[model samples]
Target chain A: MPYGYIASMKARPGHRDEVIDILTGGADGLRTAGCHLYVVAAATTDDVTIWVSEVWESKQHHDDSLKLPEARAAIAQAMPLLTGEFFTQETEVRGGLTGQP
Target chain B: MPYGYIASMKARPGHRDEVIDILTGGADGLRTAGCHLYVVAAATTDDVTIWVSEVWESKQHHDDSLKLPEARAAIAQAMPLLTGEFFTQETEVRGGLTGQP
Candidate 1:
């Protein structure tokens, strides 16, 4: 099944832009690595909260992506900008731009 | 530009599946109406929280979609299952399977 995931991150005060850049900057690479959708969105009502919505070819594709060198590097850079609070959702993508439709 | 949005909803206790169904059941019609991606994801750690990640042809497409009869009906069906607390993110979807890639 396709892997659908949403990860909510809180950036430290004044670090929202930096975190968004980090997330978007890595998008091309993630796409090349099998992510069908990699959206980086900032919450409209909360300046410090950013949401990442992703659709991967499979659960393994997503899990394996975190171990990629580029991903590891990006995470290291983004970690400092975050406040360490995150809300994650992992769902079996039933359809839509996930190529499941 | 493509319209990307994420709306987080809290389903009343034991109503998560119902919300997910209401969200997913509307997918086919929405897709036919210009929604490129409409993913229904339930939070892994929070059983009552559901996240909808959407990509529409444009912001107008998304806004207009809410006025569709099918969408209107779905909202009416879902409102009672929700807690009225929602977090929304509206972003300029730069690229991805949103077809902007």
Candidate 2:
């Protein structure tokens, strides 16, 4: 199964929409660069923060995407709007044996 | 193997330590309620965001902790200091299958 990487980030006050726009633009950037899936959800009560749940075919695919030109440049554009920091983990999927699949 | 629940919270400015304190207090409360482990890490770069990585012996253990009176009460005290949303996930450990164990 493909591994998953979840990254959660919060935007600076008044900059959430711009951040989302930039993230939206990265859809294609992510796909072409090797991302298998990427989903972003704004907090129901707090719009400034967004949780990005992403997946790649494998750890190698994820690492490869980070070095992609578009991914790096897009990250540069989005990093400043963040007020705090982000948490990310490289997780192995046990979804199959768990019977969820 | 145990399951893990990762919760990432961003505290309001100046409230990070307070939040961590609340969480720390939950350590005993969690273990008694069936948690196997609970660890909190303050972001190295952002003082306001903290990532809490927790493990329960099983899914039932995690669910039971939520209903613990201490757990509920502690959340009430800590919720207000949060400036944005939190991301929580219940995940199975595929470490064994992934050759990490």
Candidate 3:
């Protein structure tokens, strides 16, 4: 089974720019960690909420990235700007039709 | 058929408390609007990314909450504390095992 993580975030209103800067950087960090199926989709509306979808080659690879400087830097930089509870989870993706027409 | 949304947000480091305040409020607002399968799971680590999992009775109902004071309030209050791009997506859940163990 493939391992993936889903996490949500909300940006401070006027500071949306700063938020995006770090988020883009965070994505860069994950890329170096070999994150696959990584999709960072910003919300369409003006709300601060965001969606982070990532599929890793394996759970071990995902866990290994925690030691990387890029990952740690993003976390350190992100500490002061969050306004609410940050959510994250690791799950096994199961089931879905893939029939091709 | 049902509708669900997944969004991600990251909190500024030291303000985790303030962030949780607004997030809990946001969840309250969502519940009033009749969200189903709403799971607001906080990340286990010090990193800020959050995961918001919500299932609506229907898409229309989910959209209806946009007008609620609580929803808007959460957004306004949450603006300055974020440090990264917020991601959101409407998706259809497909597949999984349901057999009794």
Candidate 4:
């Protein structure tokens, strides 16, 4: 089964857009590192929170991607803009439309 | 921008699979109703909790889907199997790979 997770983070008071930019900037590298899905989203009703929904080929693939140079750099840049509040739910990809058909 | 959300629900003890089945079974109808993505997943460390990550063409599309007969039926069937615990975060789909062009 594929590995997946939905993670949410809060950006510093006025830096949500900057944080989102950095988070989304590493997608190409993530795809090459075995990510099947990497979606960055922001709550419609909340300005400081951002949600990332990801599907990786495996848990190991996800872990390895975090070690990639670009990934680490992006994370470092975004971390300063974030509030340190986070939420994550690790999941086993069951099944449904992923637009992969 | 696309409309999306990550919703988590807790199934009644031992009824998680049944709920997942019903939730995933409505995919065909949802696609036709303008859903871009609908992924059913279960937390690896929590057997009774199920997470559904979805992206629709628009918020209207998502709202319309819930009124579909098939969707209503599936919800009705799954509700009894659920514990009524739910978490929902509505989002504005920013961007990334969704396995779509």
> What's the TM-score of each model vs. the native?
0.76, 0.48, 0.46, 0.96
Candidate 3 C-alpha lDDT tens digits along A1-101: 54667766776665544655665565544655656444444454545655555555577888898778876787677656666667667754322211111
Which should have the higher DockQ, number 1 or number 3? 1
TM-score, predicted candidate 4 vs. hidden true structure: 0.96
Collision pairs in model 1: none
- Stretches of candidate 1 off by over 4 Å are A97-101, B10-18, B31-34, B45-48, B57-59, B80-87, B92-101
- Clashing residue pairs in candidate 2 are none
Best by lDDT: 4
Model 4, runs deviating above 4 Å: none
- lDDT for each residue of candidate 1 in B14-98, tens digit (9 for 90 to 100): 9988888888887877876678778777666777888788877888889899999988998999999999999887865544343
Scored by TM against the true chain B, the candidates give 0.92, 0.86, 0.76, 0.95
* Residue A97 C-alpha lDDT in model 4: 83
lDDT of 4 at A8: 93
Pick by DockQ: which candidate is best?
A: 4
Kindly report the docking quality category of candidate 1: acceptable
Give the per-residue lDDT digits (tens) of candidate 1, residues A1-101: 66788888899999998888877876777776778777777666667888788888888899999999988998999999999999887876654443224
The candidates' DockQ values read 0.39, 0.04, 0.04, 0.75
Ranking by TM-score: 4, 1, 2, 3
Name the candidate that leads on TM-score: 4
